[model samples]
Target: MSELKIDERCKSTLKKIILFCTVLFLVSVVGAYILARGNWELIEAQIAQMMEGVMDNLNIETNKNFGLSLFINNLRAVSLMILTGFIPFLFIPIFILVLNGIIIGALPMLTGTNFVSTMVFGILPHGIFELSAIILGASFGVMICLTIVRKIIGKNTVEFKILLKYILKKYVFVIIPLLVIAAIVEAYITPIILMNTIF
Candidate 1:
């Protein structure tokens, strides 16, 4: 399918959406980290349980299959964000982003490691690509949600089919590739780097 040409106004809106999502994610992370500090033991246990549930759901068996598993998992997560755009006011997609931020923010305390070191060695290598893809997907999701809201309010808007086509093209052309690279780095390169530097 041909890529849809986004007008300057739409481009500006998408940029604003991305910025808002980024700020929301960062705020959630910082807030969760600060809140967990006062009652770390309980928060740590809850985080552990949540992680265990996620791992169990993923059914990841060993390091050999981790990259593929992680890719699938991340794809499913971002897809959900896109799909949930039908929800009014972008509630579900926004909630998903914030929830992910909280989990990531708690990782340092959960591992009992230095925050900067853990983020630098363990998360940043893959997180840059992974987070970018997720945020992009979510921004589009939020855009979709906003379009629906506009239509409901009888405002002039692009056709839903055209907007959706544009988003799908972006997913195929942009987001999926980033996730693939992120999975590879997270599974192989990240471990090697951590082994040498932190572990």
Candidate 2:
């Protein structure tokens, strides 16, 4: 294949991965929202129960380390998602995305979102980067699946190692940094904004 063809194929693969991420996120969000819409009380109760232990130790004063903690936690999750991308199947990565999507979608429905602009302003600071990293990471995971398809169809000559290297570079240089920024904003800035505006 020529350079031009390779470029086109790469672009096409990126488009497909993005589409997959969007579809999965939307589906999870809609599904979670629908599932919890009429049963918000139960969801709320469950959430409260889950947060009990954390809430007990939750101290705003001790949140000096919260950003770091949050970053590491998110990084761990993203790492898992990216690792799953090494698999030539969509099951695990998609499963992770689906579970996340449901949680993302259900949160607003369970919590009751009013004032769209204010809410967006509060969440957007961190959410934009965080969700993008997640979707992108998940896409990276699905890249192998695409490679498999290409090999079976005789369109791609790239070896699995080369593609894996590219994906790893993306994770280390791109996704990790985005998640770090998101963690900072989420732990520090987002809460302040929410406290002043939406909350």
Candidate 3:
């Protein structure tokens, strides 16, 4: 193909990708709202069950032990799981995304308008960008795994180290900054929003 044609093709591919991502996000959000609105008690029970499963598997002992170290360990574990479960997750990111969206959405729903608005504004400062990074990271991992599996006969030649490095760069570059932004938002902005609402 000509250079101009290639450039046009690239732009078209980019646009399609963006449109797909947007559609995915909207679908997830809508699914979350529907699921959340339907039987909150069941949703709550499912959340508890999931947490219990994690706790059982991880052997989390106490609240004190559930601090920063635990959080980091969990993060590492999840990133590792992404490598293993990458391909499977691509077809079901909506399931995970909706579950999370519902949980986040539920908190505000229960708290009434004042608190909901407060949380909305509080979360927005970082949540949008942070979530995008997370979604993109996951998407990249899923896409890479899918591509490799489709092209290769056996998984023996999967250059896991290189793939892991690529994923980790996204984690370090995108997710880490997102976490920092979220922490600042939660620690500073949330408290201020709450205080202002109260006062």
Candidate 4:
């Protein structure tokens, strides 16, 4: 196929994959919320422990260098999602996405706070960019797995090298920038908003 046609095809495939991941993430969130409602104490403890572990790892004592720390942490996470695509059948990427969704869904219940307001003021500001980057990364990861499956089945597929180049190009050009903006907003603006409105 011509380069333009190939690019178009990639874009189309990416759109489908992104949509699939988005739906999966949403379902996971809703499922977790329902489950949490049924077993609030257990889920709350689990979520709290997970958050503690994450905070410990982040070691974010103050907001002075919070943006840089958060950016690096997010970069590592999204990069891992992409790397895990090398595993066949999209297992790891899906797990990561679902786990993230579960955490988000459980957050309001865990904090014993207003669900709508907490999500609106606490998560949405940075979540828009952060979640978009995450979903995009996971979609690319799924694409990698699909490419591998196609190659195994002797179907016509873009060479792995070309696919990797395209993924990396998009990661650097698109995902990284989104994450950078997300980290800045989450570290600086999100806290301020939450302090004023939610907290």
Candidate 5:
């Protein structure tokens, strides 16, 4: 009976994750398409500007040769897990995930037909695995936070040591593996894809 209850809870959690992913995907597609349709040229211009700022900040000379370098360097900037933890709010990781989903969905639509192939080559290779890991990590973090919130509301109390142990265990078992996957994609797959796609 207890095992059945655990299974049911797992199923429910998975269902929620799927629902959230679907909603994010659909919303991003619509939003990206709308934005691109209204002012794709302007969007590109802004992206170029942002790219310039990033390059300058990083002290990288603006040249096409640094294409893959730029992508790799910029990955950390939009890294959801990295930034989400810094926020003062509890739900920040969830919001970051949703926002990233929107931008990622719209990215291809913003580019030219020729650029789509390039984008795929550059992003898809590592992006698929890398992004999946990021989303999973972020989701895990959000779920853990939600659990804490639930406990707080239910009994209006939680022992600090117990909560701390639970949090640490979740991080050890879940977040660590996700981070390892992310690192693998970033270090090995992303670079090769970027080269093969762009060149």
Candidate 6:
């Protein structure tokens, strides 16, 4: 019976995570599409400004810096969301999800093609795995924060320290591997594909 209860709870948590991630992703894509449509020139300018920074620093010839930077950035992003899960609320995960969705939606808009086509052609290579990692990381954060919130509300708490340790352990085993593979694909495979097809 206890095992059944635990299974049910895990299933419930998984549902919540999927619901939150989907909602966040969809809403952010719509919002960003509207924003990009309204201010395409502004978006272009902003993208150019950002690209300038990347270009100045990244040596495309070697791709060494690009890979390292991409990996570090992904690691940092995942770590930031995971660590911030300590505070009770969905804000951090929602923010990360929305931000990522916005960026994803907006990037294809800048290319002057339909968003679906652009995303399919441009981002699909690394994006599937990379976005999965990001969503999973954010979902883990949401789960942690929601668990904390439930405990505070009910005052029948799971020991936060123990919960946190479990979260950390699961994250190391689950999310890190995804992020690493994503970083590797983004750094190595994505550029070459983009160069040939999209860029």
Tell me the TM-score of each prediction against the true structure. Answer: 0.91, 0.78, 0.59, 0.94, 0.55, 0.79
TM-score: the better of candidates 5 and 6? 6
Question: Per-residue lDDT of 1-199 in model 4, one digit per residue for the tens?
Answer: 6666666777888899999999999888778877887899766778888777666656367775778888888888789889898887655887888888988888878877776787799989999999999999888888888888888788887667777888999999999999999998999999999989978
Point out the worst 10-residue segment of candidate 3 by lDDT. Answer: 62-71
Q: Write the per-residue lDDT of candidate 2 for residues 3-109, one digit (tens) a residue.
A: 55665566577778879797878778777777777787778776555445333444345466777776776776677877776566454777887877766666676
Q: What is the C-alpha RMSD of each candidate to the true structure, in Å?
A: 2.6, 3.7, 6.5, 1.4, 6.1, 3.3
lDDT of 5 by residue, 95-172 (tens): 666655555545565444343564467556655655555555455445445555666577433343343454455456
Q: lDDT per prediction?
A: 0.84, 0.71, 0.51, 0.85, 0.53, 0.71
Model 1: colliding residue pairs: none
- Deviation (Å) of 96 in candidate 5: 0.9
Total backbone collisions, model 6 = 0
The sequence of per-residue lDDT tens digits that candidate 6 reaches over residues 103-178 is 6677766667667756766677777776777777777677778778888789553455555666677678877787
Give the candidates in order of lDDT, highest first.
4, 1, 2, 6, 5, 3
Clashing pairs in 5: none
Prediction 5 global C-alpha lDDT:
0.53
Off-target runs (Cα >4 Å) in candidate 6 are 1-8, 41-61, 111-114, 155-162
Per residue, candidate 3 scores C-alpha lDDT tens digits across 39-106 of 66667666556545545544235433433333444355335434543564244443454444554555
Clashing pairs in 6: none
lDDT of 4 at 178: 98
How many clashing pairs in candidate 4?
A: 0
Clashing pairs in 4: none
Residue 79 of model 1: what lDDT? 96
